[model samples]
Target: MNATDRTPADLLRSALAADPARPLVTFYDDATGERVELSVATFANWVAKTANLLQGDLAAEPGDRLALLLPAHWQSAVWLLACSSVGVVAEVQGDPAAADLVVSGPGTLEAARACRGERVALALRPLGGRFPQAPEGFADYAVEVPSQGDRFAPFAPVDPDAPALAVDGVELTSAQLVARAREDAAALGLAAGSRLLTGRTYGSWEGLSTGLFAPLAAGGSVVLCRHLGQLGEEGLAKRVESERVTNSAV
Candidate 1:
């Protein structure tokens, strides 16, 4: 909302400072009956801790490419903002072998191992839990993130003009990401206090624009669902009624 909010991190900070108690993201897994809601402040805390881990433990610097081989889930959203906060490039569904770091979920272990850099694995369990045992040759995100500092400041300034995201043959600078998100916010009819329900499966652009970026840029909130097919039509209608979703994109 300010002139300086030209990047995802900036917009997040503004949201936190403006109304920390507002629900920013609510996640649900229809197959597992799992629900998690994060206020702006809570989400920011996760981003800060994750950023600290990326900068301090991983020694990742600006322009470092991180292959994000995770499905559309809450943890994936955290990693995306963590990369933006530290000016790292988040390559969702990208080639792991070409990246400086690789983050994989349960099913992508083999592909993640092909990456020649540091590897991190997320169990993608309930409550963002760690794996029962650490995956060989990979750091467990749940094991490492909790001990990281609660606050984060990038060692070097994050450049808004720098490339921040890459996926599906699309690359966007942080500034471009914000600009496009703003346009999408308008087109999607998202404004302050809007509550949007959306499917977790999104294309690269759709994921960034409507799923994460546009809601944040527009001062609204999102209710993201995974395994939506498991929620039958009746179940989905019940959810919409319970969550009071104002807009839906499924």
Candidate 2:
């Protein structure tokens, strides 16, 4: 880890500076037979656009609570980093009633209505496609995000000590999150260039650390699998080989 990295966004920036072309996230949806790979530069571009959408279009300010109701998909990862870039306090699977903004998947749009603030809905389609029709009372994320600027500059500087994430009833500041991620990476025996495969959801601290933060902090990449149980042992083995995964937490 870079000594100067104080937040998740900082870690990502370091990664971008070191190797922009290296694959950072390789996502798979076993149920749909979908696979997508994102290099550091590609991931950062997505984050920038999404951050622009959050800060510019949604008018999100630092410290505002954003309820993130999405599955363990690549887009979910993008939103996580985007929240970090803008200093938005991301609440994973949090109560919508307490959020200043809500971003939900197609499965949770009804539940997200409790948020009296801006609401965005993701169709969770393959290739990040937009919804066939925009859901009522919510902006379509795929549509709105594309028009956002490719480069993001937050209106105010993010504070490393400020609250950044709320997950599984635990709130962690950006600095604490970075420290925990580095610790978790060490505990998992992940080193630079280590490729981790995980089927874990992002609903708990353990899952979040293993699936996203740990590998990222370790200067490694992740093969995030959704509905991994559907893949039999033989298929899983083939995937591990094909993806060159060196570590696993499934």
Candidate 3:
């Protein structure tokens, strides 16, 4: 990885340029029996659209804090990069009341409602479907994001040195985040083109580092597992063989 890489979004762009067809994030929910794979181009497209939703629709500006009350699902990952694209501060599982925007998953209605800022709710349904009905005081993310522009351009340039992520009382700038991810990639044994499988229940730096950032920074890919407890050892071994997973940290 280059020393100039500033944000997680930059890593995605690099991967898209290197191999657009290569799988980037392969998501699985053991309990729900759902699997979705995204190539570099496809993942970038989602990030672009979601970035537009955050900047254009929600008017989220640089330095604004977005409380992400979501698990390690693929959509949650998308939102994280979206925040980076638009230069908004992404705070994982942060206090909703203090945030400028709030994004919540299926069962976080109470916490979502506690946020007075702009709110978005994800159904986490198979195929990323919309909520059956709009959650009060919240916009349905699935319905809103796709209609936004396919390409995202921030209103103003994002300073790489500005705060980008906060979790568990720790804060890091975009530049710092990318630098740390590079360090983590080495520690996790991720190599270019490697396929790493990991669990998706990570709450802070450790989870984000190995599950998303490490592979991305190393020009590799991730197979993120949710509800992993439901998969037996034999089933996991079969999946590793079928998916050709090069490594695992689960």
TM-score to true structure, per model:
0.98, 0.99, 0.98
lDDT of 2 by residue, 176-245 (tens): 9999999999988999999999999999988888879999999999999999999999999999999999
lDDT tens per residue, model 1, 181-203: 89988888998998888884644
**Consecutive 10-residue window with the lowest summed lDDT within model 1:** 200-209
Give the better candidate number (2 or 3) by TM-score: 2
lDDT of 3 by residue, 1-250 (tens): 5557788888877888889999989999999899999998898999999999999889899999999999988888899899999999999999999999999997887987878889999999988999899888899999998788888888998899999999778899999999998898888788999899998565878888777888999999999999887999999999999889998888
Model 2 misplaced stretches (Cα beyond 4 Å): none
State each candidate's clash count: 0, 0, 0
- lDDT values for all models: 0.90, 0.95, 0.89
lDDT score for candidate 2 against the true structure: 0.95
Error of 1 at 92 (Å): 0.4
